[model samples]
Target: MNIELWWPKLTPSTRVGLLENNGDAVPPQVVAEVTRAGGSAAIDSDSEESDYYLSDEDVEWIETVTNEEEPTEGLILSKVRRT
Candidate 1:
């Protein structure tokens, strides 16, 4: 997907991490996904503040290499016990 078409779909609330001085540019699909999830995204130097951060190369991987069908299927989940 072209970044120009999907870039506007990103909401201000979506947080995206971007590395400075990296040659790669963020794909619009990533931004669209973040916004669709109702989260905030931005390219910033500080990773501590952002909910999710990724390097320029990482971003490219996410957009091109990452599996879109099962985005988070590999994660291990645990049930929380109530006090």
Candidate 2:
């Protein structure tokens, strides 16, 4: 599977260097997901990222990565305990 990266949106004060500079470019969840799925991802920092994003599947995986305290698949149900 070919994965495309959507760089994170730049904040108002984020403009610090040349527009083409990949150094300050934000890494999106696409990079993580592609890696997690056992595939390689290509970064296209020049491309535009939309304000609206994150499909259902994308959201779930992003959460898993941010919350490093838990594993991805078992994360959700692991928190729910029987009363």
Candidate 3:
């Protein structure tokens, strides 16, 4: 499953965790769930073969789901420039 496909199924807390941790520090259960959903590669930042950078739509969805106004200065998403 693509991140876009599995993302909406994630619990709010799980989504917030991903946003807060910048794709790092994912809980093992969440990882397992993502793997089951075929999105394991999407969270593996260390995998050279992984092309899992967040898209603009992903960022928008995160903000909307989390009710965040915008990426703050210290948020990792703030540094991501989706082209």
Candidate number achieving the greatest lDDT relative to the actual structure:
3
Q: Could you tell me how far off, in angstroms, the CA of residue 32 lies in candidate 1 after the best superposition?
A: 1.0
Global local distance difference test of model 1: 0.38
What lDDT would candidate 2 get against the real structure?
0.34
Q: What is the C-alpha RMSD of each candidate to the true structure, in Å?
A: 14.3, 13.2, 9.7
- Tell me the tens digit of each residue's lDDT in model 3 across 50-83: 3444544555555643554543433333222232
| Candidate 2, 1-83: lDDT as tens digits | 31113212322122122122222233455335435544433444446753223333444444443343443444332222112
TM-score-wise, the better of 1 and 3 is 3
Where is model 2 more than 4 Å wrong at Cα? 1-51, 69-83
**TM-score order of candidates, top first:** 3, 2, 1
- Per-prediction count of colliding residue pairs? 10, 0, 0
* lDDT score, candidate 1, position 48: 50
- What residue pairs clash in candidate 2, if any at all? none
Better of 1 and 2 by lDDT: 1
Q: Give the alpha carbon lDDT tens digit for every residue of 5-83 in model 1.
A: 3334544332233222123434566545845644334666554543333344335434532223322333222211222
For all predicted structures, in order, the TM-scores are 0.24, 0.25, 0.45
